[model samples]
Target chain A: MLAVLVGSGAMAQEIPAEPAIETAPEPEPIPEPPPVLHPPRNIVAQDVPHDNGGVLNIQWEPPIEGVPVRYVLEMAGEDGFFQEVTRTALTQYTVMQLENFVPYRFRVAAVYEKGQSMSPETEPVMARDHWLKLGEMPVLIAIFVFGSLLLFFIQAARRGVELFVRRISGLTAVEDAIGRATEMGKPVLYVPGTSTIEDVATLASLNILGEVARRTVHYDVKIICPNKDPIVYTIAREIVKETYASEGRPDAFDPDSVFFMVPDQFAFAAGVDGIMVREQPATIFLMGMFWAESLIMAETGASTGAIQIAGTDSVAQLPFFITACDYTLIGEELYAASAYLGREPMLLGTLKAQDYGKLVFLIIMVVFTLISVFSGYDAASLVRVR
Target chain B: MKRRFPMTIMFLFAIWGGISVFVGKTKVHDFDNLLRNKLLLIVGAFAIILGLGSLIFHHTQKIKRKARFWQYSYVTLIALAVTTFIGLGGGVRGERSLPTIFGGTVIGAHDGLVYVFTSQAEKNLFMDEPSRYADPTKAVLELPREFETDFNRFEASQLREEIHLKHTALQLKGQPIPPMISPVSNQQVAYKKEFKISLQQLYEGILVPCGSTMFAMLAFYMCSAAYRAFRMRNLHAGVLLVAAFIVMLGQIPLATAFIPGLHELRQWILDVPNLASKRGIMIGVGLGASATSFKIILGIERAWLGGGE
Candidate 1:
């Protein structure tokens, strides 16, 4: 048989018997499945505060021992079908951009290479819309206190209680400046700052501008208000027109005097500078929120030998104005100018209220400093506004 | 009616604005935004019209009376007209919708130059495939990196998504890369093409430089003003001069090295006196401004009503 097999193999190479394939050794015992993943504990889902809803803050405590697990956050809406929202190795997540008033149930699953272990589903947390934010408590308190004081003083003033506001030299010089303009037969350049009406400083300046306009109406000094904001230009035209009309010199109110120059800050400055160099108004009121242009305008007016009165709540620009302008209203003086100059009882009342508030604040500040210094009580920390 | 109507509206809106601050958990979810935003848009439209009217009237009067530097008004008016017309004619982005109904699904242009919108190749539409790399704020598009972008997450998410439809798979034999959305769908689609002029290009190229140039004139004005301001004549001026000089010197490391404790002095001035004064002013301004708001609301301040008209 061996000879036949050898002869067959020799005759045809394909005649060789197929070698018996060795039976595969029994596969090694299948490795024990990885230990069951430990689910996270203390899963809490809460609505985010001070938001317009649609946000949930989910937090969990990770199990100490896990099979190299990653946490998978799953959410189910009204559809009740849990969908994997995200995966993370974090203990907390702020889910954002959800629909308001939607009930969302969240579950966290510890997912390992072998299997997953899920925590019990959290109670459906409905995101409720909240209006007031707790962060603004200090602002609210300050406003309430300040507003009540103002109203109280105004009421007192209305009932013939005389309120005294300190004299501001800048405002007292208004008459002199306008008088000088009337004597020089030159225009009175009243700039209501480069800012719009949204700025309180601009509003304060506008109030002062109205008074200055009224004062100049009988004096016959042409008042030119170069406006940088169109709305302000329109409003200024009205104020000047009304002031002239009320003073029985309606024809003197030239609409073009309150024209708007370019809105660009520097361009407006340049335009006003050109006007200053050309017309050389005897008096200039550079008031309101001015930036770099404050110096340029004031210096140009000063170079023209005009009596320049600059005022602004912007402390950065105050130094420049004080250096260039003949009279500068620093900080609170700018706000106090309307009452000081116009002598309106309503405004004077507000000013007095502000002074009282300041006095109270100053006393508290000194007391707090003393406490913080000597007693180490940190009273400053308690009343810190922002 | 003119005064009362506005005052009523202002009072109501002011009250609304003030009260809206602390009502987040109420049933009025987004009521503040909806009402305020809508009203603002309407008023803004009217304000634009009024602004245009005032601008035209002012310029026309200037030209009629031949006011000083009246010739420059013509430049402004003409520029305004040209830019407004250009913006209107070409649209802000030069995007114009022309509807064309073509039968069949995604019949691309010759050489597969355009992609029909039948296959959701539109901007802002969700993609079937996920992105390669994801950031909270980065746009998902694989656009050319040369384009400048904003750091706004919402805007980035609203951009066109990258679709990797190979030209070979689409049987595009030979084509340039001007990916376009065709007008096969009912909704409007943008068909982009290379080398097209746009109004945005004009705005970015011309108007931006003009504005920048106008702003650039401030440096010269500042230098001139500073020269006039820094001169010493009085004690106050001397104090200011010394303070400014010290502050300026303290900023320079070489000067600080020579004058030991100069930087510390400057820091003390800035931290103690300067900050104290600033805080005092800020508190005053805050109270004053809030009082003004209350005054306006209560109708005690009528200066905005035109000299007590």
Candidate 2:
């Protein structure tokens, strides 16, 4: 029985071959060949205008025959092999990074799924650099007119011609603020803005600082100037030292007075605020390029009961300075402050030129507005800068 | 002559700047970019040396003199030293090593199994879920990428082979079944190959929070400024107050639900009057900046030359 069971098991384990069933294979569908496409026509390649050289603008009309998936832009040097520059679906493409003043030829290839056809090669063209950007003619003309007026006024002032000047209350208050600080026996805190020398506002603030330094020396008042930029720190130190020498009191210029605070924005604001709260300065000068921290510093100064005078060319910061400070220099007033205080003929002449420039700009705005309203034309395009 | 020499160079560069703006030449732009980027950056880098010297000198003097708040100077100096050391020695996210001891055990049988950990936090993390981090069949711990360091890193196949060999050896011993982690050995060699707290971590953990706190203070300051400026004292103040009120009201959904026209009124106020005034200031500022640049280039504004007329 055991042998019978073993034999049956072996028989069960033995593989049985099933009868093979034959079947016909389904017919495969043949793929149709892609239609031929013609290359673009009237291909024009020229140097881009009013830009640095080594760039060419290529444009073409669509092909008359079948459309292509994309057009391949190929370029070659005078004798170099053709290389694919770029592929574009549009009719126009800007070829860049070519050698200036070197003639090059370009061709367009209409690329299809199966095949591609090349357009006739364009004439050899060289990218030329323009000496003057003609697209900036409007700006150049305006600069010329304004600059000529400045030169004329500067020349006139150099000849000792008396020019009428207006009085700015903010400039007049500088002396009083210094006197107030002197009487209080507290230091005058001067923040020459939390910006680098690259900003003109900081330069203007430094210019104003020189005059303020001179006055502080004359009045025997202590001045605490904190800086945020390393370069500005060096310049401010020199200005203060020079101002002391010019005022015949070199000993009073403390080397540590014009110190550098942290260069961070909010950190500088917090440091200045801490100084305001601790030192309790009698007067604070917030001048230079300021962003969101303007209000924080100004309000802190206000809380300290310090006489604050803020000036900034940053239009967004003007409202903050105006609200928190006792005296605020608005818009162009900050730039005019140095001249207003110095009373130098050349500086005053430049200030007058700036006013004239504004007048001319106003007239231009009026004329443009009239043209836009009457002629229904966008005259802004004429002066629009690229 | 000291000032005149610098002014002469400044004059040349200024003229070059003005001319370069209108010259569409690649060489000119290249030179201009070189001066603006490379030259300025090199000088700025050197200036950092001067800044560090000044900072160190200022703090040293304060500590020597026992000046006001002199205790704070020590803190500043210590912080500076620590930050510099960490910044230079250990790069922002550079690695550091530490010893690690692996410990775990299965508590109960079936799917309700728990992992016995040395620390309570780790125990709670893997409680009643041994399969969450470790595979019973695989006999390997699946550590998160952030937690897995070079010393602890093991290839899956290699670790499985090692664990399998150990498991088979234990099984052949004919002893009672051992714990999941005990089978791998109590003290597995692991040298922590990465720092858990790096300079970047310090910056994000400390400086970022401080900066955020400072920035958050702006809201209070803005409120104070607005409250003071919006007082009904003069015509301008009244106008500002009303405009601010309208804008504030328009920003809220409840006010708009009451009067939909308030939104349009707010839009007109912002788009027309506010934008017009902003543009006026912008134009004035632009002209003023241009004039200042011209003056500086012409040497009419000599204050920037370190205080010479």
Candidate 3:
């Protein structure tokens, strides 16, 4: 502001000397200087919530008129260490890295033409870390609700409660896919996904493979599972061996049935395609997570006139499998296939609990939608996940 | 307890992973980085080494037994062995110390012979000129001269060094025959690498071609599958055929140019029904995965531990 006055004074030198009319020299009364703007109102400082600590937030309401050119905020703690944190036009400032346990005061001032006004120092506030963050309330609610429902269903099943789940045709045809291979005197090819065992989709595939192996052992059908991940291949071998043994067909289990191919994505796909072309299997089961290779395996199987059954959690690959395979279990159907096939109470009860959780989620969504329509408040915003 | 032990570890680790997300930009972030980048690599390295070992053992057994297609096993084994040796000996970037077999004769780069060189401008490479030379030969450059006559890099390098030295000196003295011209810039400099069989060369020449060939096969498969799938066997197949036709046509600018609103229709179809269905499947998949994870964490699912055993 002082710079603005000095700039105006320099411009006076550019003007021609006021003519002799200035000789009249009638001295005039000096105009009064402009009034200074008042400082902001209702200054408050509080601890920033839902954090690990060492932060405080300060807010103030600007005066209705005569606003300042800018606002300056400062903070002070023990030892009277007051220092300007930052200067900005915003009405609120968050002072960070304050001493965790020490109280701190904040002052906000407004700068005007030639003067400034400072608000009274805010009541000292201390930053503290809370054990639990309130920002995660929605997440906590979801977990608690879903987990409780799951536990409840598990207890109910332990008490001999019966559960009913509609049959998924894709799983029902697992026997047909295996039996066709047996009748045709060809091996049943099973690719338990090209991904590592760490992926949940691959784990889901393994669970279904167990049931398929048991059925194959009972029917005396040959089942060959090729894997791309070494750990998955080893565990698949174990699962097949145990399946045959438990079904009293130990001799039927072949260790070479579940083998590891090269770990390269396209290499695995080419190897599997070669297996499809050469072996000409009666049926191929492609399950788990796949990328670009999904269609390669499925289309090769289709061309060989083999019955292809594919199930994967990869949404992008689902279209390819649906286009080329005889039966493609879409999305959640793949995950649910294991429980549907085995019908074990442990699996069935979880499916039941998941249905209940979905119901609650549906109700919540419906309620939020209606509230937003009638009350004009976005209730769904309360459930922001991240 | 055999099953419970791994489950307990998984549960604790999952909980810690969840908690780490909320800590947000704190010291825990450093720990997360350490675990993800360092610890995971340590574990993955062992898994990969064991996997390679198994691959070697598997192929050798196939060869010993004379299994069907056993000849292909030899190819895989030889390729694996050669690549491993080359990768370990000739480093990924060819930085490993293997003795240079050929003389270090770089064709374009400075190799101790000089002739009149081109500076592209008068007097010097930069700044104002001292004086314009009527005959550029009077300047007498001290830099590497470009090979104006066609000379094979391999052939030239094999020639005796004295031949190039004697010829370069004569050319610098303004001899009418065998004119020496220098490259205008670095872009014009052409040099053959000293080592021919580099790791990157093998990867680009062999691995990339094979991978690309496999990926290219998808084009044929896609066409054949489309033929079978769009058979018009039912209403659903007919709908798919029509939708596929429009989407494919909309992708071509010529088709959309003939139909003014075709692009808008394509965008609406993608952004509306296609995205809606995709997101719907995503949500269902998410829920199923969540349920499955919970089952695994609570020990309700145990097939991963070798079935019911």
Candidate 4:
């Protein structure tokens, strides 16, 4: 059976004895090649003035064939050194950071990723550090307008300008709270919010603390001041000490009364609560940077039946203080509290300037809003030098 | 003369400082580091030490007097002594040897305490065959290597044997283990594991809430104080009370739920009138700050350095 199988396999191999030849048909020649892209013509380079230096604007037109092509902008110094600035699919580019007052030759080339066609160089253009003559106009106008208004207000105040500031209820309550404490023969608790001395709010609190100390001294009422920051603690101590000294009641100044509680926020709050509960001061003064503790401190003080007056610049905590404190200074009023109490001329002048600036800002805002509403946001109309 | 001389010097320095910063003449980066890092950091570190000393002294005085809860003083003292000893030991065995030892001990003790309480609690609560509880061997094994290092193996093995014995005895008695028992033990193990994981998370999360918990909790105490302290008993209080009420009710969801109109009113209060008032105050503050900054720059505000007193 194996021999028969072998014989059959050999016969199968010998069955296709005739040799075969095969051939492939040639492909048709490619169609005519596409036209080449040519370089742009009429290249122009202009110096952009009023800049530090080395800036130029180059523009050109595409060849008449109008085949879509990208433009290459290049610049070379007088020393025949060159660098490609940009390869834009547009006809223009602003070349910058060129050497000032130095001559430069620029050329434009039409380019595709595959190839580039160069244009003849434009006549050498010199970039100059041109100081724009009219550049100072806007600043000058601004200075003049502001300076005149400042001078005008100064003179008006000199002529006894009747500036009417709205009454802040928080400020009005300070005296009442202090008076209540004095009436009760209980100590007035003053806490310059949990911020360092460098914080404006802390300084403002210090100023108000001075005023409170003055009043407390006059009333022969005890005052307790607690601080969260060591630096603020020192400042508060100094302010209170100086105020007492100034009042000629240096003996009344109690160092123990003004103590540094834990610098930690909640720990400070807890300590303050302990103080409020233990001391049961008739009135509590809070001013400075406060957060969630505003409500905690205020609520605790409220529970103690201690009149609480709080001031802070933390917008998020203001609502909490407002709810929990008898009187709460919101936002910038904490800043104004110091000026209102101290009546420092520099502070007062700055306050007046701020008011003036705000008035100007309001007017500008109104005008801008009206113009935007009417003009439908035309780019040309909104453009201004300043 | 003492005050005036300092004031004069401060005023000049403040002005100089302000001009330098505003004119961009002073390198802001260098100045910021000097003020924030060098000055503030040194002062803050010393202040922290003072705070620690005060805490220790106050507690020590309480202990000496044998005041209420004075026994807690021993706990604090032991902790302090142990921490100092370990810290000063300088990791003679290895850098992390002491920490690993202490940390492991704490973790093991915590787990032991949980196990004891939970097991006893289950037993007292009439939990049948509580030992048949879901085995937490895998979870226990999964505990951090550091924790396992100080784990009380004897205690763990004893507890396991006790549980196994109880379980086998209950099974032999043909009594089914109570659902609550097994779940509670499983939960205890899960809780222990979760605690460790959460501690890891606390150290890893964007904020370490542990450090800030004391500060954040003050909000609660403050709220209590405010309610008791703030009352519209007088004229000034009346105005403050009204504003406070508006602001408070306006902030919560209750106001919107009760009176839809109040939401708009609140918005107006915040966006318009409130913003206007805030801006007005801010403008004043800005000017004040400018003047102060000017003074500081000119060296008039030397209070920052605790000088010029």
Pick the lDDT winner.
2
For candidate 1 chain B, the 10 contiguous residues with the lowest summed lDDT are B103-112
By DockQ thresholds, what CAPRI class is model 3? acceptable
Give the Cα error of residue A154 in candidate 4, in Å.
Answer: 7.4
Off by over 4 Å in 3: A1-48, A51-133, A248-253, B18-37, B99-193, B196-198, B252-261
- Superposed model 4: Cα runs more than 4 Å off: A1-24, A28-165, A343-351, A376-386, B4-13, B20-36, B43-288, B291-309
Looking at model 1, residue B238 earns an lDDT score of: 84
Taking chain A of model 3 alone, its TM-score versus the true chain A equals 0.73
True lDDT of residue B195, candidate 3: 36
Q: Which stretches of candidate 1 lie over 4 Å from their true place?
A: A1-40, A48-98, A106-121, A131-134, A364-386, B25-29, B90-206, B232-239, B253-268
lDDT of 1 by residue, B255-299 (tens): 999999999999988898889989998888877777777777888
Q: Which ten residues in a row have the lowest lDDT in candidate 1 chain A?
A: A377-386
Whose TM-score is higher: candidate 1's or candidate 4's? 1
DockQ scores of all models, one per candidate: 0.28, 0.39, 0.29, 0.10
Question: Residue B30 of candidate 3: its Cα lDDT?
Answer: 62
Per-residue lDDT value at B154 in model 3: 21
The docking category that best describes candidate 2 is acceptable
Best by TM-score: 2
The alpha-carbon deviation from the true structure for residue B26 of candidate 4, after best TM-score superposition, in angstroms, is 7.9
- Candidate ranking under DockQ, highest first, comes to 2, 3, 1, 4
Worst 10 residues of 3 chain B by lDDT: B114-123
Query: How much is B309 displaced in model 4, in angstroms?
Result: 12
Model 2 captures what fraction of native contacts? Answer: 0.57
